[model samples]
Target: MGVWLVLAGLNGAMAIGFAAWGSHGVEGEAARWVGLGSQFQLLHAVALLALARFCAKRRRLFRPAAGLMVVGVALFSGSLYLKALGISLPIPMVTPLGGISLMASWLLLALAGWLACDHARV
Candidate 1:
């Protein structure tokens, strides 16, 4: 939980900083990528906070969800950031992998909520 909070804070701060940079310093397609990355980072940072709350009750599901989110943000947003900086990597599949991870994280979160609801009914 503590680690999540810290990560959330750092991600949020980076998002804000990147957003500012994108608006002022970046342009064209690079700006678009930076903006997209910043948006994802900010959203996932907030998601991390929500996941922390959910984890208190459903540690099993939420913990893995959090982990997936972290990995997703790292790969997806990280790749976009690097691209924005005009850096290309030899690994072309990284962005797609990150997208899949992000989708999986959302599915896990939904499953966690469903399981919690089912447990409450019992």
Candidate 2:
């Protein structure tokens, strides 16, 4: 929850930065990457918040789902940010990891819902 809030806050800042100072800063490959990445992060933030609400009563479910979300964000969004920023790093394989994390997150969410319902009857 706190993590989501922080990322969401960061996204808000980045979104504003891109909309404002990024005009000249974001250009070429890096620009497009940043722009798209920022949008993705923003959307992810919203989704994460919503998911948190849904997972409120299911802490066990929330744990894995939240973990996946964080991993996914770090991989998927994090990659794009670095790529866009033209950062000199070992061209990390962050995007794929993020994608896998996202898929796991979605699947876990479903599983969590089922588990929650099952436990209700137990």
Kindly state the number of residue pairs that clash in model 2.
0
List TM-scores for all candidates, in order.
Answer: 0.92, 0.72
lDDT measured at residue 74 in model 1 versus the true structure, 0 to 100: 93
By how many angstroms RMSD does model 1 differ from the true structure?
A: 1.9
TM-score of 1: 0.92
The per-model lDDT (C-alpha) reads 0.89, 0.70
| Per-residue alpha-carbon lDDT of candidate 2 for residues 6-31, written as tens digits (9 for 90 to 100) | 65566556556654434577777777
Candidate 2 ranges beyond 4 A from true positions: 1-3, 15-24, 116-122
How accurate locally is residue 75 in candidate 2, as Cα lDDT from 0 to 100? 75
Badly placed stretches (over 4 Å) of model 1 are 119-122
lDDT by residue (tens digit), candidate 1, 13-59: 99899999889988999999999999999999999988888776756
The model with the greatest lDDT is 1
